[model samples]
Target: MATYPQEITLKVFVNKTKNCVDFVESDLDFVDVLLSFLTLRASLKCECGGDINTSVSYDLNRDDVNYEEFRGVFIKGAKFVVTDALCISLVEDLISTLNKCVNGDRNHMEVRLVKIKREQVLRILKRSLISDTPLTDVLLQNGEGITPKFSDSLAGKKVEKKVIDKEKKVCKLNMVLTRNKVLYAVASQDFVDLIFSFLTFPLGSLKKHLGSRFRMGCLNNLYGSAERLRSSGYMTAGCAERLLNPKLAPYFNCKNQVIGVEEEKEDLYYTCNGFCKLTALYFSCKSHGYSPYHESNQVTLVDPKSQLGGTISSHGSYCQKLMYMVTDELVVTPLSLESVVSFHNEIADPIKTAELSVTEAEILDVLAVALTSNTALTDAFLGTTVGVFTSVDVKGE
Candidate 1:
């Protein structure tokens, strides 16, 4: 069973002069809560925040993630501050004003500890997809509201088919279209693998791909602030670059990945002649900490999930070879005649059959639609919604 504390406390730095939050200081647990918002496949929830069930609905597979596994996802024992570029600038201004103050007045700032509940966490998760100021809307404003409707520009636009060159790879999909909306699609393992890969994508990586159109609540503004800080030399080393374009962790990349995002490769390391482990950058003896260590030959690690313990033929297929039926809302299951019939019974319009040969670009479009709209299949193909089917042409052997 899924479990979390009823409430977690945070110390927020409020600027009394501006009547806004200057920054927030919290332990790793609060950071963990923030990070959890990114990993969720939350499109399943109603945009109005009505149908959200935090315990089981967010977990794609109903498995309860234990504390040890959760710890591995983020670094522990670290106290971090959450603030944007604007807040940083405000702090700098405040410091300058204080330095020149005649009375040594420090009454403009105050810190207060606030309790955030599980319901608020859910609100933040939901608002992340809709509002750009989710923290302000939920924390400071104390409102559980959401922008349920997308922009009008996205709804009525026509989806033009991009011409594919001869060398471009494609995934073949059989779509059931009716009244200008895609009812469902019959996709093979290749396409199924692509959709399943969505779970592994980081929020920053998604922002990198989607650009200004990413529009996942405060995350867009957050990523943009990070970019400005990086350009202005406010960020140290490669921290900004890593945050802006994070690569997937090792072994998480799919073999048939259509998206152009990079993934971390399994690195081979060597030990010294003294049998001390060594990395490419740092060479320290395990016994004598920080001591110089000579490099030996590289040692290869076996793929844990591979068959026969050799080079894995396939690295990331979560399911077996089977035709899958994907609904517009992204409910994926094995394709069956019975399931198709049940779906067919939901509509009463004249249906049309079309085989969509989609390339990498179209697959990315599908990803974008899945994130932004509930009618993913329809928007990816037809770019609009309409009534359902009356007559159907069911294909068979």
Candidate 2:
């Protein structure tokens, strides 16, 4: 069930009458539950059907489902059909709600303590950096994983014919960006959290951010080919297309000094929509002008949603409301330390910071071991989240 829905929520109906709403874990498969959540058309089956062409509706947001409630909903929605984009959107929203709940909810939950060795954390960090795979994939592949375990696969479904995937599997990261410069990077929501985990110290301290500025040295594996990534909604339709050709590029300003915005009626494609924005936040920078530091260019980790449907500009506390700009949670530049200070000064809030230095140190260690020994990165949660008294620690970022 969605922990909290901003507006419309998943609803259910039986014979033109609203039944129950939101997520209810019944014997029914989760997907079937989602389909049943919708109000069925009149022609759909119903026990108390007054007419075959009528409909019923149902939605509820009371609290967690009880076993009894779960059983009933399961039986009722057993034969429900109709799975479409709406189901996908609801699922996406539900994912967000779960994140908020997991982060904030503590009621009726037991307290637990977890202690993780620095070595375990460092191992995972190094492996991802060296292999160019997302950290999650590194952790999941188990024992020197050579292939990415993160990409999804629809098993049993034959992929439709494709000109791109069928051709030589070109690693887009191999294309160096000289004539084409990146205006922005869009990461999905899960990626955002992963990047945050990397940027922030695992152990808690008073510090809010890791580091204000550092150079992005990894882009080879992270940059999904433009078209493939856009379909996921991290960016607009033309984003990858425009970048492929500099003359038509819409991301940058005329002088190529700044980025432009992709506007919609109310929603802006400035930042990522959600899901992978954080992961997308880290770019595999292959642009010609890519630099560790640019005196004139300033970078800030942007939370696109913070703007309240506003544009993104390189100004303000979180950042000035420029056009709808997509950004990851952190930004780095080769700009001088003074430039880094100036970049923070523009912001209105004093936030938690993470330092890239710690990550860099891990990278060094991992590279040393990898060169001589095929040491791969691996990590695991040392404790559970269900607890009343929870203690968190950091190994010093």
Which candidate tops TM-score? 1
lDDT of 1 by residue, 19-59 (tens): 66656665445554554343333333434343334432222
Once fitted onto the true fold, the runs of candidate 2 whose alpha carbons sit more than 4 angstroms away are: 1-29, 32-148, 151-334, 337-397
CA lDDT, candidate 2, residue 110: 29
Per-residue C-alpha lDDT of model 2 across residues 62-145, encoded as one tens digit per residue: 245452334322122221111211122223335665456435543422222212122323333343333333222222333264
Top candidate (lDDT): 1
How far in Å is the alpha carbon of 359 misplaced in model 2? 30
Cα RMSD to the true fold for all candidates? 10.9, 24.5
- Residue 5 shift from truth in candidate 2, angstroms: 16
lDDT of 2 at 390: 17
